[model samples]
Target: MSTKRYCLTCDLKDDEALIAEYKEYHKSVWPEIITSIKEAGIVDMQIYLSGNRMFMIMECDETFDPVKKAEMDANNPKVQEWEQLMWKYQQGLPWAKPGEKWIEMEKVFQL
Candidate 1:
């Protein structure tokens, strides 16, 4: 299967306590959510942070479709619960679409 990489950006609440809590939550992601991620065709994912900004890199098989994955997550009660908790520390980028949480970043250069 073909593999694709996606880059996404989001903003975290600038509060230190919130950021700390966010990191703590990620230290042990829910098992159910982890299963959902694999089922969605995502093989690898990483998040990096600077100041209040966050960047996520994801590698997935050709079967992965962000829209489809999001739809599936929406229907999953556990994923929805996790997302609701995460919203406490997340903010959409200023230029993101109304309902968007993470904005896909355009790749400029690659070697």
Candidate 2:
């Protein structure tokens, strides 16, 4: 099976204590969230932090449809709860739409 990779970025409120708390929460994400991700066809995911900036890498199967995933998430109470909790620490990029988080990054280079 072919895998597609996507990179996304977001920002955290520039508060040290809040950032620490955010990391702690990630250390024990709700199991339902993990299952939801896999059910969305996301085979692998990783997140990295730099200062107040955050980046995520996701590898998904061909079956992954972002729109479908959004619909599924909307119907899942656990996912909605997780998103609401995450917003405490996450902020949209400067150019992001009013409700957008994790903006997708453009790939400008490849070896």
Please name the candidate that would achieve the greatest TM-score relative to the true structure.
2
Native-to-model Cα distance after best TM-score fit, residue 91 in candidate 1, in Å: 0.6
RMSD of model 1, in Å? 0.9
lDDT tens digits, residues 1-111, model 1?
779999999999999999999999999999999999999999999999999999999999998998899899999999999999999999989898876788889999999
Off by over 4 Å in 2: none
- Cα lDDT for residue 27, model 1? 96
* Candidate 2 whole-model C-alpha lDDT, 0 to 1: 0.96
RMSD of each: 0.9, 0.6
Pairs of residues at least 3 apart in sequence or in different chains that clash in candidate 2: none
What tens-digit string does per-residue lDDT give for candidate 2 at 7-76? 9999999999999999999999899999999999999999999999999999999999999999999999
